[model samples]
Target: MPRARSSGSPNLACRSATTNCIRCLPQVEWEAPMADFLKLRDRMVDIHLARRGIRDSRVLQAMRTVPRERFVREGLEDFAYEDSALPIEEEQTISQPYIVAAMAEAAEIQSDDRVLEVGAGSGYAAAVLGQLAGEVFAIERHTALGKLARERIAALGYDNVDIRVGDGTRGLADQAPFDAILVAAGGPDVPAALKQQLAVGGHLVIPVGDPGDQKLCKVTRITESRFEEENLGAVMFVPLIGEQGWQEDGRRAASNHLPGASKSQSLPEMIADAAEDLPGFDDPAFGRLFDRFAGRRVVLLGEASHGTGEFYRARAAITRHLITHHNFTIVAVEADWPDAATIDRYVRHRPHRAGTDKPFQRFPTWMWRNTDIQELIHWMRDHNDMVDDMEARAGFYGLDIYNMSGSIGAVLDYLDRVDPDAAKVARERYGCLTPWQSNPATYGRAALSRGYAECEKAVIDQCRDLLRKRLDYAKDDGDAFLDAAQNARLIASAERYYRIMYYGGAESWNLRDTHMFETLQNLLDARGPDAKAIVWAHNSHIGDARVTDMGAARDELNIGQLCRETFGSDAALIGFGTHTGTVAAATDWDGDMQVKRVNPSRADSYERQFHDSGKSRFLLDLSPERHDALRRRLAEPRLERFIGVIYRPDTELQSHYSQAILPEQFDAFVWFDRTQAVTPLGPEHHRGVPETYPFGE
Candidate 1:
């Protein structure tokens, strides 16, 4: 997330003993120096405006005055002066210098104008606007980014800026009547609130349309009653996520308090309404569906390798919620019982620093490290007497220790000792010495070892010892594992484990393979009628693929195909994608590229405006063979305006490649009469030119 500029200094009042001293301090140094900054800034302006045909001077000057280096990450300060977006925390990005300039210029800011900026990332654009406008109000949705932006702005001493934390699409309704609005994020359409908030003659500049294609549109209030819309150029941005934007979709399954009644409403509406529901207390039907295992006996299954932050956060939330608010009696994490016994002792004695060591440093296990988990454990321990009583009444059973593979190993060792009839199966399945080598033959060799035969006898003795120990301390055997419950949820860090385990083999683990869907289906089937499960996965995995080609199935079978085969009509799924602008960067390139921005001629009709001008504008559609060849040929950066094409195998090959072209590879595009290649929306409106047959007009 980009940081915002902070609001200025605190006021001070002082009284002197001998004399009355009253003075206002000099305005804090909020404004960064523009002297040495202007040169590099001007160089960027030339690259974007003069070289790339950015006609808006106000945009250029704003770019010039605002020191972009101040808003960028410290390491990326050198590239700050360049016209390319940089990644910030949370996987968000600060817009490129030219894009900021172009967008700000398109907004048509005036000296006394009040501007509203959506996606207040890094506060770079807001800082620039502070120099151009009277009041700049920037909204950042991400809470952390919002705080960072406020800190940066305060450091720079920008007094004219007001940073607000809120959803951007909704716009600050209380501060209605903005002279101009700039949305940094992309959306499928201009948000209605932004349009309504624009004062007469105000301009709203935003990138609008689908993720694959978007237009930087400048909407100006032409009169009190009408507005003029001009397509500026093509651009890409992150999706604008909020109530008024694209919604996340998925199924919600739990105890039915009227599940059938809520089925008629749209999934988007459900998600929007459910946003207010507390994490643990949401209505079971919808909340449990999205959250998964809301009020159930869950055994969190963790892999040795930790996953991404999102996965960690989700698992943590689920574990916390279950322990705090459910009838969950037992938690069986994958660790050995002896290791868990040590953890239990640590939790009981050193509550604050329980198991705060390697491997056990994850949540619940390392309870002392996390304040929330520590508090929950304290509460549970305090009420242990009552829990023990309940356990006695219910005839509580101690958690069973079954390290599926380790148990198999123990069984194999026993088979070797007894020379049982099923000894071959044990040898083939559980005799491997190397933990990494899971082949059946290795298991057989291990089962045949003399050491394995001895170990099998020892394993049975150990189980008996554990059982006897439990019986000796039998006052509340059920409550013994309660301390471990915090870390014990059957949540796998990698979905691949679930796929491999359920499929009984590792042959179908490819992300691109449709077998992934089959695995999910098997998971659903295994859950059975009494059990309900929610899958937290990418939009491609859960969405109905038949209607939309925007999911993973575009590379395999559509979402609808999988849903029908696996979930049937009983399961509901939603697909979500952020529509941040169009392709600003080349698919294969790392940095940003400067593409020419063209507008429709006033004299030409909407359709005729799609035609080629004398200026260098051409579209090139390449065949698969040609595309691969051209990609290697024009791998270097060059000055040209052309659209690029990638073959979509899921669609009919000819139909998919029919209008596909290498626009970046060509000098200019011409409309081929025979191919009917002119874009109905046109390159001028859609951001790239249409492919033509001949080289020139």
Candidate 2:
């Protein structure tokens, strides 16, 4: 007979970070599950929960112990550990890990507390809560999902959990006075039954408002007939179907309309009324926007898309003001390091070899190799020439870490010039990667497979050797040595990043952003304590992820999150957006550049509201002192469009729009009602740019 499995689940049994904890089951019974599942669960707890501020220890332990794969469909077990939501039976889904963690952390579960869970699709969240509380009662609306959840819970040995099938909107009255309640679906408003069932001092966390758009609200029972509500942030969920919620058909009565849609004035009228608050982009009065952030050490500039001309021009204009008036020192962007270094050499008048003059030649080249960016480079060069002190000159650099091959070459070339012996060792270690230089993904696929050796050790050893010999090389050429060392670090990080990407999980995304943030920090430290810098990247990178679904669903963080964590009030983040326009993008990866037409803003989006304002262009300050009406409009969650270097108009909504709490994500926002694509410097650029609006409306 096979040895009995551990009485306690893996989560409760392992107190350490590693998945090497001994199992009670026989070797074969344990190897299959513990090999992949236990290791992934441990990583999920460390990276997704601990690093993201998910504090409650009980919540973390429960999350780590639960076998998420058992709760998902068999074929999708590979994706069970991911932070994203996955489909379950009866057209339901298991809540994303971060979302569940957020709700659990918000509930502040006590050791002896009883919990109530609404819309328990897969019973995954219930199992997690069971670990934190004394008992958990989960209600599901779909009969099949309820039955499946019960079976999963029993099979997983969660004896503290109980499953029931009913309209979760009404809650479980028979088991009243729950210490905490978590609703997995969105409702028009907080359900009365759920509120009444909560004991004093208990919390009810639910997504409240429209189904496709909602606010995560936490309601606390203060006393008899007294309760408090706090808007946690924006969220999106399917409708809660039942009495006192959405109708069985998912429609509301005529008297009850979507949130913000029942106002007496039409959308156009509301925009016209707020016209006084809209300031022209070119207005001299608008200069005060950056003026308020005068003493900030870092200012992050964000663009909705990579190829919007207005975004590039606007950020450049602001950057110029900062350099000339505020004494800002550097401009770092989301491009390859070597490519931006070429621009840095040009601006500082350093000699550059002929072949290295043009730096950007990759996919989405228009992002940096365009006329708009060309003008900025020229201006920086002229400005630097006027400055006598080298330290005072504004410099350009790149913070992204996607150029592994280029970085490897840069490191080798530097070592070859300074220390031939070190170069030989470097070449030997890097040789392990040379075979897959053109496409790192090929190596990643192999490394992630069974029995395939990883080059991680070799790359790390090479980085260590370069750092050990840094002083020797620095004596000859300090800047070159510094560049070489940074490249070595980038290569090691990128090698691991590519491998993680092959797993199709959040680790790779997190690694890339973390690398960029570290690069920015290094640049700042190298510039001295008094230096200031401005960052240019997509809104998705510059906007705080904690307030968006990106964070909740994917456990992803970006440069903006790092800045906020590191600099706090010392950093300012500003975002840009547009309603409709032409954008320079490609149909596919490495495809031909095209000036594609951006779809008009959807009806439920913030862009639609801005477009209706009848202003061609404007800036809306998001500070607390702004007009209450303007703040109110932006405070509510709404659809926000995000276009990258690639665009597909047909799948715009599915691919781009995300529900976002505008005021919470950025300090200020700039909007252009109508815009056009950036003009590429080369002749081949306009092959996709049409000559007229609608090609002549």
Query: Which numbered prediction scores highest in TM-score against the true structure?
Result: 2
Candidate 2 Cα deviation (angstroms), residue 426:
0.9
TM-score of every prediction relative to native: 0.35, 0.64
The regions of model 1 sitting more than 4 angstroms off are 1-38, 223-225, 248-664, 667-697
**Tens digits of per-residue lDDT for model 2, 213-330:** 4679999999979999998876657787777678867786333345665524443444455443434445545555568877899999999888889898888888877898899988
* Cα lDDT tens digits for candidate 1, 1-697: 1221323221111000000011111222233345545665776677444555567666667677777787877655544654446667666788866677777777778889999999998888899888789999999998888888888899989999988898898899899899999999777677777888999989999976544235678999877778889987555567777666554331211221223442332222222222222233233332243333243222222210111122223333443344435443333222333233333433333222222222222221211122232333334344343554443111111121212233344334434444455456434432322342233223323445433434334333433433344433334433332222211211111112222322221121223224334333333333344333333332222333332222211123432245455545344332211111121111111112222122222111111222222212122222225444334322222111112211111111111111111122121112211111111111233233112100001
Whole-model lDDT per candidate = 0.42, 0.76
Residue-level error in angstroms, candidate 1, position 85: 0.8
| Steric clash pairs (candidate 2) | 11-65
